[model samples]
Target chain A: MIILGVDPGLTRCGVGVVEAGASRRLSFIHVDVVRSDPHESQDLRLLKIYRGLCTKLDEFIPDAVSIERVFAQANRNTVLGTAQAAGVAMLAAAQRGIPVALHTPTEAKLAITGNGQAQKIQVERMVTRILNLNTMPTPADAADALALAICHALRPSGALQGGEREQHLTQAQRQWAEATRKANRGGNMLHRGM
Target chain B: MIILGVDPGLTRCGVGVVEAGASRRLSFIHVDVVRSDPHESQDLRLLKIYRGLCTKLDEFIPDAVSIERVFAQANRNTVLGTAQAAGVAMLAAAQRGIPVALHTPTEAKLAITGNGQAQKIQVERMVTRILNLNTMPTPADAADALALAICHALRPSGALQGGEREQHLTQAQRQWAEATRKANRGGNMLHRGM
Candidate 1:
């Protein structure tokens, strides 16, 4: 199954596409950033981000999209921009009929580093190791996007396939299970998108 | 010129289109709501809104689009949804080449009721009076949408043309000036967005 991870922001958005095999082995497919100038009008900036994601979706055609969900208590300007960018990412995915999931910051950090409050560099190192890359992704946002995709792919409930009927999966576990089922379906490529 | 005002929220997005004569006469052209169910996933809800507004813009083809800029200090859930909805609204306008203007909530209230902190009923009553409508627009969001269009139309700097340029026009004043000039050129219906 293919997963596209999105780290959304107005000034710079990071995106990564990765393929996970039936054996759960992962391979990096693509990584890039979409940037909008800070001095541009809000309309132009938003359109750039929206159009960039739409183009990426058309190019990569990932089975599922994983987006970062930000906390609202951050610096107001950053949070507002991030939220809007996230909306555009979700819009692009939904318009194309791709299944989408949101991973909170803590959920992502916890899944990747086994610690909710792990530092950025630590998370980046883990993403590099998991993807089996010799050099880390250039920008931090790009590596973060890779981490989100890995979190979606390898999280516990999804990983523990044969152990069904637990009836007590954590929220994260439930998300992983549902997301895995949805992506694993991976409908025919010839008849994709609305 | 025709102005389409947007009150951005995922659950209930309000839209109002008004015709403002060079004589400064205001007439209601259209008023409606775009709604999304809360129980649905965020992507689906946002896509519904984005599609609905795109349909509205295509139908109305207004000369300009006006949007409400929300403050970040509001409830986290509501604020996040509002910001994303606002981004979608802007994207619709930008995609169609329509000039877009952002109005603060306080600016809308003050423009309509002469008080930034005016009560909802007060603003609704004033919108009814100004538009010469037989009754107030239903739902406070609809009324607020009308007020945003009116704020974009009748604000101080845009309305105070040919008046001496003070040594220092406030930032809002400058924006009103630029937005008015761009909207006023008001190219033929064939070409439009900013």
Candidate 2:
């Protein structure tokens, strides 16, 4: 299975693609940060982001899309732009009949570094180690996107053979997966079951 | 010239179209509220709103599109959904090569009721009066949409002949128009100069 992850923002939308094997091994396929001019009008900036995501969607054709889910209490200044970017990302995925899942920032961090409150460097280090890459992805947003994809792939419910993966999963991983599953069941995650 | 106004929201997206003559006479063309099921996923809801706006854009081929400009300090619970819906609305307009403008609630209310803090009923009444409609438009969102279109049409820069319209413009109208013009110039209104 292939998954596309997005760390959505108007100024810099980070996207990464990862391929997952039946054995649960993951391989990085692509990564990039789509950017729009800050001086441009909001509509045009949104258009650029939407078109860029559409192009990536068409190119990768990932089975699922994972995006960072922000809450209402997020930063007052940048939350609006972040939500708008995530909106377009979800729309882009849904337009092509791809299911989209929103994972909270904490969820991605916990999945990567075994600590929900992990620092940026720790998360990046873990993502690099998990993906088995020699060099870390440049910019924090790109690394964050890869972490989202990995989180989605390793989630308990998202695993191909749930029973086998459950036995090998760590205590932190199990707890995170269970929490995510409950969130999805409670309709808080905003997953599109396409 | 025709203008399509949108009061964007996820559950109920209000849309109105109006024709503006060179003499500044406004005529109502069409009005409807595009709705999406609340039980649907966010992606599907956004997709529905985008497709609905695109249909209106293609049907009317409006010269310009006007949307309610919401601020960051708005209601926290609904602000995210509103911004997302507005994002898709702007995208729909931009995708069709139509210029888009964002007018604040104060601007629309002041243009129609001569008061920025006008009540909903008062704004609705004034919209009916301005459009010369026999029956008031149903739903507050629909009325707000028409008011936005009228606001955009009467703005100082949007008028066909600024000098001619200036003679009959009220002090409130002139002030509102001036504010909008300045906001556009300041890069605060997010007007797409298509």
Candidate 3:
């Protein structure tokens, strides 16, 4: 299955597309940042995001769209913009009838690196290695988007490993397991507006 | 000029349409609420908001949309949803090429009842009287939406009264005046992402 991962933002949003390859391996298809001009009207800024996401949705036609959940404790100033950007992403995917998944940043980190508190550099490094890319996904935002896609792909519904591994989980893995469970359940969770 | 006032939310969004008459009088055209199912998926819930706003935009075709500027101090649990709802409203207006205005709840109250700290009941009373309605607008959300429209009607861009009132503004009024000035100055202010 193909996945589109979005790191939603107002000034610069990250978008990454990945497709599952043979033996459950993942390959990167596209990655980039969608930037909205701050000089433009707020409405126009939102339109830029909405249109950009729609274009990507039409082009990729991903089986599922994954995004980082907007946490309440994020930078207070940017949280709203981030939420709005996520709204555009969700709207685009929903309009096209695509499934959407939201992963908390930590859940995404754990899925990719088996650690919830992994730093940006560590996550970026792992994303490059997992996708078998020669270089890192630039600007960090794009890499974060890729991480979200990876998180979704590793969910129980996306791969058998995730389902079987749930049975042998450690006590500390319980939280991560619950997180993936909510995501794999696919839209059963409440709308946290991300 | 016609104005569409939006009190944005995830569960229940209030929308009101009003037009300006001679001597700066305001008359109500319509008022209603758009509600989303909490049991629905996040994407579907957001789609409900997007579609509802699009329908209202098509039906009203207002010259401008007036929405309450989302405040950070709102209920933590729902702030993200409120912001997303606002994003949808902005997208619909911008896509239709209509100008969008964001007013603080205080700004709306100040416009209607001449006090920024006025209570909800006071604002509702003023809206009913100003719109020449025999009965109060059902649901405080609908009343608040009308109050937003009334606020836009009395703004500097919406009416001459707003321009002249700037001369006698209070200290608190000065800040709001500057805020609107920034919004009208076309994205001159820092992007707050709301």
Q: For this target, which candidate reaches the highest lDDT against the unseen true structure?
A: 2
Instruction: Score residue A95 of candidate 2 by CA lDDT.
Output: 94
Residue-by-residue lDDT tens digits, candidate 3, A3-48? 9999999999999999986766999999989999976877899999
Candidate 2 chain A TM is 0.89
Cα distance off (Å), candidate 2, residue B7: 0.1
TM-scores, all candidates, are 0.84, 0.90, 0.88
For all candidates, state DockQ relative to the true structure: 0.32, 0.44, 0.49
Docking class of 2: acceptable
Clashing pairs in 3: none
Model 1's alpha-carbon lDDT is 0.80
Q: Which digits, one per residue and each the tens of the lDDT, describe model 2 over residues A1-194?
A: 99999999989999999999987899989999999998888899999999999999999999999999866667656777888999999999999999998888777877777787889999999889988999999888899899999988876564323567777778778767765655566564432221
Candidate 2 per-residue lDDT, tens place, B1-194, comes to 99999998989999999999978899999999999998888999999999998998999999999999866667766777888999999888889889998888888887888887889999999899889999899987888889889988877663423567666777787777765665566455322221
Q: Interface RMSD (Å), each candidate?
A: 11.1, 6.2, 3.2
Fraction of true contacts retained by every candidate, in order, equals 0.57, 0.59, 0.57
- Better structure of 1 and 2 per DockQ: 2
Cα lDDT tens digits, model 1, B20-57, are 99767899988999999977888899999999999989
Ranking by TM-score: 2, 3, 1
